[model samples]
Target chain A: MSALIDLFSVAAIGAGLFFFFAGTVGLLRFPDSLTRLHALSKADNLGLGLVVLGLIPRAENPLAALKLLVVWALVLLSGASTAQLIGRALRRGRK
Target chain B: MSVLPALDVGLALLVVGVAAWTIAARNLFASVVGYVAYGLLLALVWVRLYAPDVALTEAAVGGGVTGVLLVTAGKRLDALASAEVGVPPGRALKILAGALAALVAGALAWVVLTLPSPAPSLAPAAAEAAAGPGAGLGNPITAVLISYRSFDTMLEKVVLILAVLGVWSVGADAAWGAAPAPLRKVRPDGAMILLAQFLAPVGLLIGVHIFWVGADAPGGAFQGGALLAAMGMVAMMARLAEPPRIDSRKLRLALVAGPAVFLIVGVAGLALADNLFAYPQNFAKPLILFIEAFMVLSIAVALPMLVCGPPNGSPK
Candidate 1:
């Protein structure tokens, strides 16, 4: 059971890494500001979320797991709001 | 010998790549976003390195708080005419700098991995020693932070209060405008508003739970405080609670309450206990709990105020 959990954890972490790489590549390759934001918003939030999920089982106790959850939730909220704010500003600039 | 090291190496490379793109990006907005992404990844690196407390702080303040600040600044800057910045640094310079950074990072990583394990971490020892007499809290971090290291925590609150004062002093003239129109109208009946309302309360409850549980668990004052602040943010955005006016005495009180309470408690400790800020061993848990609860309220108000800039009046 522990081995399976560990395997699952590793897979989740790998997925996070993939998203991070994709986000970075998009940022470098994309031409427009909006597209780059798209890359960042999509990848960074999910990447961090997955990483946290992977670490959940490894947490020393329930409190640690709760902490991880708080971290994840904060990332999700801040990521989306900030991205939205940036997108609005970009549109305003275009006008 | 282990797979963890390999995973760490891979993540480090990815982080390096993202940071390079972020710093070198042509568009300022893209660069800001990249910086945020880099901070998030850096937090993950911290977690891999076995510093969960630092990871939490980095993720919240570094990734979340700083990201919002940068994005707001970028929005404000967007109105100015776009002037093309100078050419990117030469490839040779980039390579030289990159090589040097890599060398330093490599050396540091080597030192960290090679360091001999101490017989016992100060944290566990402090927890055990304090459990019998000083601050009888089972959680080492909390005991260390609010008791043994209470002076540092007191000063940190002062720094936060000073920061709020500085913001008010400088940007006192700016009006409290609604978050861009789209966000303002967030449809009274929108599903998102309903969801936020539902989630906000639950999040607050959990935050309190974490705060209460911190005495023996992984949660603590910072996480609890951040979660509480997040609830306040959700309320402010959903228009469930109006943004307080700059001149409102209530707003001022909330801003100052954490530091004032901390100082009072610290001084009281001096009178009641042998040392300054030496929380009474019997009531240490409750004392820390009260301090954390108030600190959470203060942080929630102060952080948003910082992001909102100077409050002119209630947002229309």
Candidate 2:
């Protein structure tokens, strides 16, 4: 059971890596500013979230895991709000 | 070799990719968002590298507050520029800069992987020293911040107060009633308003909890205060509370309260204890806790007010 859990954790991490790569590709290939923002928003949030989840099981204690969770939650909150603010500003500029 | 190191390498790569996109993006607004994303990813990297304290600080100050500031500034600047005008770096210049950045990244990675571990981190020693009579905390960081390094923390608070004063002196006040062009009046009964009301109190509770737990865990005054500030911002957005007038005397008092209390406490310590800002060994926890609580409240208000920008009741 422990081996299986470890394998699953490794796979989750790999999945995170995949999302991060997708974000990079999207960032480079997207034609417009807003679309690239969309790519970054989805990719980085999911990528980091998955990675943190993968690490939680390996944490030494519950407090350590809680700390990891806090970091992830803050990131998500800040990332989304910032994206909205920037996107709104861009739209306003065009008008 | 463990697979953990391989995962660390991958995380480092992600950090690099995010940094590249942040600086290279054609749109300045997109670039600011990219920077926020970069900071968040970098915090994760810190976690993977076993620096949880640094990670927490990076997540709050770097990813959270800095992101808010940049986006607010970007919005103010957007009105001055045309989006159609792209500011792409010259091709040769880009290549040269890319090579230089890559070289620096490689050097850093090499150092990180090759550096030998130092014997005995100062944490254990600090923890041992803090375990003296009347010390109530088990967490080394908290002990250091409040007891051993109390002076540093006091000075840090002073810096924060000075920052608030500087911001105020520069006429940093949010433009009242300058909602975005698409701003619609959020009904007081709307889901968003209701949600803000529910979350604001809960956020306040969590902030207090985190502040209290700092003595034993990964939370601290800065993180707690920033969270409270975030709640305050939500309240402002939902119009649950009206923005204070730029010249309001009450606003000025709250802004200065944190530092004023900190100074008073420090002076009392000098008279009662052996040194300035020194809490009687038995009173360290309560003193630190009291100061942090007030600091959190002040910071929560001061930061959002700073972002709102200038007192003339205009958005810019």
Candidate 3:
């Protein structure tokens, strides 16, 4: 049972790491502001979520596990909204 | 060799790389962003050193709040900078400055590498008071702040309040009671407004929780109060709320409340406990908690006000 959980955790963490790598690649290669923002927001959110999920089982208590989820959720909310705001700013600057 | 040491080496390298980039970045805004990244990396370094309380402080004030301040200042200065005369320094001067900077960096690295092994630690003293005293706090840092070295903490609060006063006085005489300009962008930003509303409640709760848990954990008034101040800044930036006028009675009261309460408690200590800031053994925990709660309130208000700068002058 513990081996299975460990395997799952590693897979989740690996996938999350890949997402971060992809996000960095996109940030460098993306042609424009909006696309770059899109790449980062989407990739980083999923990356953070997976990382949080992977680590949750390792938490000493249920509250600690729950707090991990809250951190991910908060990041998602802030990231999406910030991307939107940045996109708007980019538009205005171009105009 | 364990993975941890390797990770630490990588982290240190990353921090140094970012610091170099931040210094070298040509654009002011880009440099500020790089500096923010540097601060975040430094926070990780602090965490790895088994100082999560310091890490929290670094991330909140050093990275988050300072990032906002620098970026905002950079934006305001951009237009002025572009209009000013441009003068490029000779290569000889640049080379000389670079040599001096390298010398300083080398000296710092040498100091860190040669730090005495079996580090001179005050852990024994800190832990003895924290555990032996009936303070009953789990965090040694909190015990040090409020129980052992509390007068220093009170005086630091005084310094913060004085700094805020200095910032306020920079405004023109006619603008004393006027509200400072808000941090919002030119457009009516719907996304920012929605974000502020969504995050502010959660952030405020977390801030309070950080303060509450601080008695036993890594979180504390400084970290939690910074979070609250950030929430306030987010609200102001989204145009959801205006900066309060500098002369508001209630605002001034809140600003002074922490230090005042702390000072009063200290004086009372002089009479009751025979020394300033020394609480009665039985009542120490509650008194510390009471002091901390007010400290959070004052810090949360004062920091954001400091970041907002002063009210706009009549004719700048």
Candidate 4:
């Protein structure tokens, strides 16, 4: 049972890391601000979500796991809102 | 090879790179962003050094509050469009500055390298005090700040008040006692309003939690207060609230409450305890918490006021 959980954790975290790497690449390679923001917001949020999912089982307690989920949720909220704000600023600048 | 050393090396390199970028960035805003990043990275370094209190402080005040303050200043400067953009330093001045920096760096490096093999530390004594007859607090950092170094801590709050007054002193005479300008000149869109509405309450809860836990844990008044200040600033930025008038009695009271209560307690100590700043036995923790509660209030108020700058025009 423990071995299975470890394997699942490793696979999830590895996948999360790949997404993070892809997000960074997109941030650097995207042609414009809006597109880069899109890449970053979407990929990094998913990356973080996956990372949190993987770490939940390894948490020392249920509260710690909940805390991990809370952190991921906070990040998602802030990231999405910040992206919107940045996009609005970009649009205003263009105008 | 152990991964820890590699991680340390990488962090060190990253910190230096970010510091260099902060100094080298051509755009003021970009430099400010780099500076905030550097502060956060430095907080990580503090954490690695096993100083979670300092880490929280560095992340909150150094990175978060300072970032907002600089960005506001930059915006004001851009609005002014004064000739103060002025001249860049000459090559001779730059070289002189570089030489001075190098000299200071060399001196610091030499001092660090020549330190005693077994570094001198007061940790054992502090721990004894914390765990025994002293404050009996679980966190030595809190004990030291609130009890052992109470005078210094109280004075630090006084210094914050002084700093706020200093910021206020530069305002126009007509604007005296008036509220500072709104933090955001631009009307924030719906998304920012939503973000502030949602985040502020959550941040406030976390801030208070951090402060409340400081008595026995890694969090403390400064960290919590800084977080509170950031949340307040966010609300102001979203146009949910405005900076209070400087002359408001309630506002002034809140600002000075921390240092005042701390001083009163210190004075009372002369009668109640042996030393001027000593807390009486058996009641140290409660007294410390009482003082800390006020200190937290003062810090939370003072920081945002400092960021808001001196009063702009007359009151609305």
Model 2 misplaced regions, further than 4 Å: A1-95, B82-129, B132-134, B171-198, B314-316
> What level of docking quality does candidate 3 show?
high
Can you write out model 4's per-residue Cα lDDT over B1-316, one digit (the tens) per residue? 6999899899999999999999989898999999999999999999999999999999998899999989988888888885247788899999999999999999999999999979898778767666653555777789888876778899999999999999999999989999998888878899999999999999999999999899899998889988998999999989999999999999999999999999998999999987787888899988888889999999999999998999989764
Q: Per-prediction interface RMSD?
A: 5.2, 6.0, 0.5, 0.5
Which 10-residue window in model 4 chain B sums to the lowest lDDT?
A: B127-136
Worst 10 residues of 3 chain B by lDDT: B79-88
lDDT of each: 0.74, 0.73, 0.87, 0.90
Model 2 lDDT per residue over B94-200, tens place: 89998998999899999888877873366766666577522776566776766666667667766766765565555524643232221124443344465567678
- Cα error of candidate 1 at position A77, Å: 10
Query: How many clashes in each structure?
Result: 0, 3, 0, 0
Best by DockQ: 3
Instruction: Please identify model 4 stretches exceeding 4 Å from their true place.
Output: B117-120
Tell me which of candidates 1 and 4 scores higher on DockQ: 4
TM-score of chain A of each: 0.96, 0.94, 0.95, 0.97
Candidate 3 wrong stretches, greater than 4 Å: B82-124, B132-134, B185-187, B313-316
Q: TM-score for each prediction?
A: 0.67, 0.67, 0.91, 0.96
Candidate number achieving the greatest TM-score relative to the actual structure: 4
Give the poorly placed runs of model 1, Cα more than 4 Å off. A1-95, B80-134, B172-195, B313-316
Per model, how much of the real contact set is kept?
A: 0.00, 0.00, 1.00, 0.71
Q: What is the TM-score of chain A in candidate 1?
A: 0.96
lDDT of 1 by residue, B1-316 (tens): 5898888899999899999898789887788788888888999998888777667667777777777767765765664544345466899999999999999999999988887886335666666546643455767777777776677887887787788667666643444332222213453333345546776887788767777777777677676666666666666666676556666678778888887888888888888877667777778778887887777777767876766555453354
**Docking quality category of candidate 4 according to DockQ thresholds:** high
- Of all native A–B interface contacts, model 3 reproduces a fraction of 1.00
